[model samples]
Target: MDLFPPDKILVDRVKNGDREAFTTLMERYQQKVFQTSMGFLHNQADAEDLTQEVFIKSYKSMKSFRGESSFGTWIYRITVNKAINQLRRNKLRAFAGLDAMKGEDSAADTNADAPLLRKEQKEQIKDALTKLNNAQKKVFVLFYYQELNLKEVAEVLELSPKATESLLFRARKNLQKELD
Candidate 1:
């Protein structure tokens, strides 16, 4: 009747020195981690690197994994914090161009206007996102890009559900103002 093996079983196995169980756990969540990283970073290579760091940190911090939350939520918190830290560390270098995360085609495209039009729109949105404070940005990214539910976003943000809702509302208002 269970959709998947319980995380506790896998965690116990991992703690008991079962390397395969750890591998299985990583396989199960790697894509989710990667996608979350991509949403935060917007760069495939950086996302991949952050994904690896997330798993490595998770493995090292396994002792702190109390079953209070799902393994997925715990891993997500770690991923979010690390990704934010990486952004902070490289803010000057990465944000200097503001196009570093965006892929550019060197060859002239046949449909030039369309590509330029979309890139301009995306740049507008990215500029709007940059206006958000870290907490607002975190909530916005998790809710929109990561497609996490209100409850999930609350858990990831470590905020009460009501507080998370308020944060999301304010983030939306801020974004709307920026874009408009």
Candidate 2:
């Protein structure tokens, strides 16, 4: 009935400085962390870097593990925090592009007739996603891209499951509206 071998045993091994146990933990969760970060940041390179940072930070703080939550949950918290921070920084950069009107003009001219094509439709979807508010974007990414069930998304977002569902519903509705 145990999905994890034993948290206490693994924790003790890690505390006693067992590098292999740490590697096992990292291997088990690295992909999940990277996927979750990519869902938030929407960039492969940045997500990969954030995933490494999350594992390092988790390992450094593992000695304080009190067994109150699963190790998975603790690491998930770190991944979410780092990913959110990265997204905010990226948003700032995108907004700062407003200063370069010539750059915006050039992009618009290059894509002048793009809206008439299928490839442009995909680009429209990407643009609509970027337009979503932060909370809506977070809920949408977690629900869809991360493939988290509603309950897990609720836990990560610190919302009641009902509230999480509502958020997801709203996010989808907004995305649909934007795409339309």
Choose the strongest candidate by lDDT.
Answer: 1
Predictions in order: lDDT: 0.80, 0.76
lDDT of 2 by residue, 1-180 (tens): 345756567777898899878887888889988988877755566678999999899889988877777787778878877877876776677688743654344335445666557546655776788778777777787778778898987777778999888888888898899998
Could you list the CA RMSD of all candidates, in the order they appear? 3.9, 5.4
Deviation of model 2 at 159, angstroms = 1.4
Candidate 2 lDDT: 0.76
Per-model TM-score on C-alpha atoms = 0.83, 0.77
**Cα lDDT for residue 172, model 1?**
94
Where model 1 places Cα greater than 4 Å from the true spot, the runs are: 1-4, 94-114
Badly placed stretches (over 4 Å) of model 2 are 1-4, 96-119
